[model samples]
Target: MAFKHKSTLLILTAGVFSCTPAWAASVSVVGLFKDKAIVSIDGGRPRTLSVGQTVQGVKLVAADSGSASFDVDGKRRTLGMGQSFAGGAQPGARQSVSLTADARGHFAAAGSLNGYPMTFLVDTGATSIAISAAEAKRIGLDYKAGEVTGVGTAAGVVPAWRVKFNTVKVGGITVSQVDGMVVETGLSVPLLGMSFLNRMEMRRDGQTMTLTQRY
Candidate 1:
């Protein structure tokens, strides 16, 4: 009788441990709304969660149409739509940058071009990254030596040079061999265009824009 009781206790303890759910290793916000969010855990199917609800160790703390806050494995993380969190990521992991829109609803990013500090205005309309002649000179770029070209602008056709940047970094995300253009005139700020944006997974939520490196 004593041996049977001990065996039963051990089996019950094993069963309890086996029933416990494993902690989630990854979480992605796919949808957000007032007091609700849709999240995917470990690349699984999306799960809809209300504020204060928990799923796969991820608890929704707060949510809105633009962003969502969650308690992920005891860490509070705010994520916009299409943003993700990877638990236990090692150093030098994948990079992502988040930008808030200005009062005028325009997005600007502070980054570097070939190690030179530059301010970039997010412009999806531009075909390539566009910089002014003066900016190129300030960055010590020999833009005139690049292939001569013409770019149309509000001020009409303007002389331009096609150049390839060795490195274009926006926040922690860095892209190499990015195509760009140097306009002789009619350009005020450097434009972050398709040349760089194409290499990123762009996500916009209300006034916030998130750029995640794809490679």
Candidate 2:
């Protein structure tokens, strides 16, 4: 009886992590069909995206189960699910959210708060998510690199400090009042970090990474 009980436990454990194979979270779009959300194309050329919707270039293409096939700019593409879009919401919530990066390591989004549309880079290396001093000026944040503050990085101890951005957007998402430090001086690109990321739907698609915020 003990042996049987042990076998049952193992089965249960496996079952717990193993979700429906149809929607296993995958972050690639080659030859499979995924539930792709088209956001933008031509890098926001032509007309800008309207509010209350995703951009026009977000494509989820793949032929695997739950693979996605859709059109963008009159072009056909295939996509696949990076992860199950279900069961990824707040308790008793009805809305779902997801983000799939393209071959160029870009997750496209088109959204505006108070009538301002913004783009962002989804960077995981940032310790606390940051923006450049210049961007800080744009977002209305007082982003002045203060005394050389010390921070850790893959290279080694580097000079860094905090600079606020007016706003940063990723996965058709946005966050405000975000405080993050710099890695090296004179670098002027916005880095998305986990500081504001902790509230979103976070998951890994192997070499592919995804962040979706469902409100």
Candidate 3:
């Protein structure tokens, strides 16, 4: 049977993960079965966790018996079996990074928001970078000081906050003064949207995506 929950699960907040220096830790999906998954955090001992359970703040959101969704550092990210998020290139090392698609053809990356660790789900459909209120609060983003707005999802219209991120970094590419949206509720993951993507040269070939800094 599929694991289901009421919409209220959207607002559930938990403890944040341990902090390491930049490019120190990583997360990966090892095996996934309906409602259950095996994952590795920071390359430590691998373990099995049920949906909604968290391992060092990496909460398992959903499992399709093939791919699994995880809430890493307050951002929702999906990954198929065997896909991993790695510590990025060294500081001032390079200005480009490549991402490989998981078995489910989804692209994800390890990054940061305002120097806070985060996981980014590639969403070309999103107009700007999108974060959940839970995430905005965790990362100390002053979204309420920005404009109030609403976002239309399949469920309905939900309240959102329009704010600017001081800096968003993925691998070695960092974009400053990025526009972002904070959904008041009903958003589980933070989307790596166009506000950041538009600043880079994005190219996809088969299962690999290459992102290079533009300026």
Candidate 4:
């Protein structure tokens, strides 16, 4: 009788193991364009899909430059660049900001520098966050006290001052002790450059760009 009970228990354990479900595929939006989106399934290589197209059970319903809508497991969802969906579970809390491109494809946002409100033009080509001398003065920045330097501009190499900012905040994201440069001339608006961008994971879809803090 004991042998019979042990056999039944082993069979039940095996049945339970056989009924367990396989791991659900994880889908992430890595790129988005007009009527098309690039997605990674199960953390695999990115695959591009057009509207109404399906790949690995994930379907793209509609897509624009800024956002994309999809059908997953019979659920309709919309996501911006860098967002993801997995096993019907929502993404975790992460510091991220989204920017919409203008008609000219320029991405800009309203942010603060050292707690002062300002506008920033996203310029990936720039090496550091750049501020104009006039704007710095208006914000009560003692730019002249920083190290004197030269920054190349459209006009030519122009006078500049290298400084550090206490904080740079954009939307809900904030970075501390960011490197910056105050251009003495030839810069009309502040440029958000690699100094800040290097610490962010950038994702662009059509007219939408997402910046997620990495550190």
**Angstrom error at residue 121, model 3:** 0.6
Model 2 poorest ten-residue lDDT run = 1-10
**Per-residue lDDT over 65-134 for candidate 4, one digit per residue giving the tens place of the 0 to 100 score:** 8989988767887888988765532355456666777665666755578967666777787778888899
Candidate 3: C-alpha RMSD after superposition: 13.4
139: Cα error in model 2, Å: 2.7
Error of 4 at 80 (Å): 34
If both were scored by lDDT, which would come out higher, candidate 1 or candidate 2?
1
Q: Cα lDDT of all candidates, in order?
A: 0.71, 0.38, 0.70, 0.69
All candidates: CA RMSD in angstroms? 22.5, 16.1, 13.4, 22.2
lDDT of 3 by residue, 1-215 (tens): 11111222222222222222233235677788999988766543467989989754567899987799887655667888888765444556446667777665666666678867677677787788888899999988888998887777656677788898998877556679998888887667677888888888888889888887777
- Arranged by lDDT, best first: 1, 3, 4, 2
Q: Tens-digit lDDT track for model 2 on 10-34? A: 1111111111111111122322212
Candidate 2: segments with Cα more than 4 A from true spot: 1-97, 104-116, 145-160, 163-176, 182-188, 205-210
TM-score of 1: 0.58
lDDT of 1 by residue, 166-214 (tens): 9886655668999899888777767888889998888888887888778
TM-score of each model, paired residue for residue: 0.58, 0.42, 0.59, 0.57
lDDT of 4 at 155: 67
